[model samples]
Target: MRWFWIFAVGHLLLWTAVPFFTQANGPLDNVEMLNWGHEWQWGYPKHPPLPAWAAEAATYLPGGPVWSTYLLSQVCIVGCFWAAWRLGRETLSPSLALAAVAVLEGSIYYNCTTPEFNNNIMAKACWAMFILFAYYGIARGRMVDWGAAGIFLAAAILSKYDAALLLAATLLFSSLHPRARVCWRTPGPYVLTGVSLLLTAPHLWWLVNNNFATLRYIAARSSTSPSWLSHFEHPAEFLGAQLGAVAVTLILATILLGWRWRFKTVDSSAQFTRTYLAWMVLGPLGLALAYSLITGAHLRSMWGASMFTFLGVLLFAWLEARPDPALIRRTIYASAIVGGIFAAGLGLRNMIGDSLVTAPLRVDYPGQQLASQVEEIWSQHSNKPLENLGGDWWLAANINVYHPDRPSISAEQDHDLPAWTALDAWRTEGGIIVWETATAGDNYETQIKALYPNVEILRPLEFAWTKNQQRPPLRVGMAVVPPLAPIRTAELPTPAQH
Candidate 1:
């Protein structure tokens, strides 16, 4: 238990502190999430609302520090680790349980990618917690456990739709096992299904009303049409990536087991635990592989985040014939090495990133300064605060997070004006239309000009990358659509005055 907490707390603190110190602001996804979180709905175009809600809650924590999102990501990661430890203790020794969690640190998903506080990170805790609850419910046939499982299952799905794969796998496992099959007659299974659907009903309705925007976004990520060569190419690449991602854990396990371990089918009572572990570990990964093969879809590396929550426990039970103290000592050393290597790599990346001439990282962008300049430029023409922003999601998110008003970012690609704001209100409120003049923003200056033909196009401003001044300056072009009515001084307090 002491070891478990040590790893969990250490993991949380290490990840949170690294990003807080190293990153100028948050990452692109982090700022985007904060933008969505500020005006949360049932769903977004790309993902569900849970991640946004979590990020929003972090920002609302008294002082609204940017580091809070990093902390939120760490909290989710440690929660997953704790869940793994709890499940491990049911079938393995305390030492083995600690190793189960320690393995997670090796994965970039739980370390390097975690501080972004995106949907993948948010879903991880829900995935682990749901698995733990579902295992207890099926094993013990307890109503309370089933209920908890249902709620968390909803949370997992709400965090990201990939959780459906796990749910399907669990159902398939229960159907095949004799003892688990008995759950069909119980109220617990029914309750679990009913609760999940009930919790998901609102998001489902939102999807229907909004024309399944999130699904379209998911489709955009993958190859919808099959290609003859991609069937072989995509899956092979995905498999290779998965192996590389999990190599550290596998290597450590291999070192400890050394081909000496064998699976023991002797214990009947343990069969269910082993089977459950196998299905949970294999299910999501198998689905991803199959999808890649069938559709030639590109499976993202981060999608593997929730798939390996129970991997360490499964490996320990299947292998690790007996505990070797020397092997255990070596495992700790290996884990430490993983942590050190990741820290050094991330530090080096941040440090050297600005010096390169190819392109500056989003972190290198002087978003706050740009926002201030844009706000000043807008205020000179219009009495009202910048009420809305128009551009690509990344640039809009940058302004959304830093601008004094924290205006809503309406992407040009958003088809439904009602989903963001009424077209009339947006036109009446009349805000800044911006596009990146260099590097990014999709070269949308022509589109913005065409959209607001009557609006005055301001002079293009060049902003230097704060961290990398040697790099060419980023040019930003803006246009202001005059507000319908100037805000009276007594009517509402300005953002600066507030």
Candidate 2:
């Protein structure tokens, strides 16, 4: 347990610090979440509100916004680790449980990609908590366990809709598994259902009032190929991607238990535990694949982020592998080795990616500098503090994140502004509309004219990349919609300039 705490702390600090120092800007998803968090809505156009809410809350921490986001992501990873460890301890010996949780360090989803705080990161923690409490609720028929399970279930859904797969898995297991069938007769199931609905009601109401904007987003994102071969190809690609994601886990497990098959007979209690773990591990994955096959919908590899929380427990339970002190020591050493390698690789990528890649990576964008210049231009035209930004998600979000006022966002593509942004207020106060000159297309002027016929297209501004100034400068095109109110000559200092 002491060693586990040490590893957890080391992991949290290393991941948080590496991204903080190496990257110049937050990842796209992280910046987008921060922008949405500022709005503090019940739901967003793309995802549930929990991750945005979490990102917004993290900004209040001691570290500045970008550092706080990095820290928040690592905190979620560590929390998932703790939940997995507790779940493992319920069925396996303490040392074996420790080994099981430690091996998760090999999964890339838990390490390399985790720094980009998003719905997947939040769902990972929620999924682990949901499984842990759901297990206890089903096996023990306790009201407290059922209540906790309900809360986490609601949280998981609030984090990502994919968590519905986990709920379905739980129901499937409860109906068929002999040990879990007794839960139906108890008050546990009802309590779980009631609490989950009670907690989720607000988001559900938001969905209803907004006409399920998230579902529309999901539908738009789903790539359905016209070819019949897509049914097989998409699922196969998804399966292969998942296998690659967990390849390191298999390697680490083999290092701990060796290459030999070590199956051992267990008591009925242990057998039941193994079966339960297997369902939790495979059920969600199978359902996802089945959905892909039926609909020919292109599945994203990151969508599998929460499906493997019980993987370690299932692996050990199936093998009946008991780790001696020597093997446990080896597992700890291997975990450290893997963590160090990943940390070094990520650091190097962030530090030198610009020199190697032709185009600037997302992190290399000069967001702060661009935001400062945008604010300067807005000040020249309007006296009002920058209250709203209108553009595509990436450019608009980047500027919004660094902008001192933390203005509301109005996506260019949406016909109606989000509920958080008052249309009348936005029209009266006015805002800047921005886009990358290269990507905005030739019709950008036409598009802006259609929306704001009187919009003044400012001279395009160019800024050097953060890492490689010798590369082509980032050219941003801007337009200002004149406010209905009178203008004054008050200029607010840009935070970047300070």
Candidate 3:
């Protein structure tokens, strides 16, 4: 209870006076999601549909007009802390648990989490909940415990497709454990898990119906994504991200202490805890390592592993004894690692002081910024607007995922963009075009000028996001159509990810 107050204050402090602005996915993207939820479908082209509902739901909260999805991300931050605390309680003292919570939250990676409408965050929450309840399930063996775990496991799937992997890891570890046969021998938990998986059918059906376009999209993107020469300098990238997601260092210390201290003498339950840590923490990392080497798996969402690491570490701490005193040093070190993150985050925020903003990720749509701008444009053009093909899509029937009802997004992140090609024709017919651009060199802009000698650039928006920099603001530039030469139909450049 006391920690709750502290957590409340901490949560409040992190988001205190924070202005609502475009976050990772941007307002345009979120608005489209809200629209999607209103449509109430099972899935979307890119991923599951839960995030759309979550983002749209966030928009109605206090200060939502400014942008609520980012605000809600703070909620995940707090929830992560609490979950870490509970996890730490399994291994460390209350004070250490609190410290762990703080560390987990402060880690630089966690602090800078940009809210995007995706499974990364949702999966983090589910991972934390899954661990907390799995602890309960193993300890109490209550049917409800497994039921709770089942719910989380299922929700995990909806959050990110990889969640199914987590479930597999859990089952694999459980089955391999000494009591594995007994655990499965019972029909109750199995039934609970079955029902949980059954719930994922809608999403599964959506995937199958679309001929697994989402998977193809992911594969296509991964294969082409730019790879670094060597991230060996920062294996910590994944490590820091995972620790941050859990939001507690003491918890992590605790887990570490237990594993190190009691390696020789462990009980069944202790081993079970260790297994959870192994699967949740290492499972993803192992996959990512393989992906990094073999398949170019974009492990950018590696922070999802933090959901389990924090608990695993805390579980380790709780299992250690203080008399040895060695655990104390480990606890201190862990706390320091976590605390340093918040300090660094604060320092960086102040250092930048909003001097300039940029999104490091090279993207085609300034979707979030575009949302607000498009909304304004939509309002002005209540009379006449051009149909937007959104972007290139593929064989799958793509629905418009843009937020504005006015500029419908063509469900094609992969196929031909009729909208881009038709921009000039639409303008000729008194149609207003709203194009999104990241760099100054946009093919669409070239096309507009080429097709219409008098191609009027209604709005030229320039925005850039660096890897870890403040996203540059959307600068709207309007160009008027000056009579020019006939534009050649040229192939638009492909995204590195695509």
Candidate 2 TM-score, C-alpha based: 0.92
User: How good is model 3 by TM-score?
Assistant: 0.67
Query: Per-residue lDDT for 75 in model 3?
Result: 64
Query: What does the lDDT read for residue 431 in candidate 3?
Result: 29
| Candidate 2 residue-wise lDDT, 75-184, digit = tens | 98888888878878877888777788878888898888988999999999999988889988887778999999999999998998998899999999999998898889
Tens-place lDDT per residue, model 3, 224-331, is 334554344234354556545554543454443544555434666656555666666666666555545554344554535434436435444435544444554455
Measured by lDDT, the strongest candidate is 2
Assess each prediction's global lDDT (C-alpha) against the native: 0.77, 0.83, 0.52
lDDT tens digits by residue: candidate 1, 64-150:
446899899999988888888898888877886777667766877777777778999888899999999999999999999999999
- In model 1, the Cα lDDT at residue 150 comes to 97
Choose the strongest candidate by TM-score.
2
| Model 2 steric clash pairs | none
CA deviation > 4 Å runs, candidate 3: 16-40, 90-93, 114-117, 224-279, 287-315, 318-407, 411-413, 416-432, 436-498
Q: Candidate 1: give the clashing pairs.
A: none
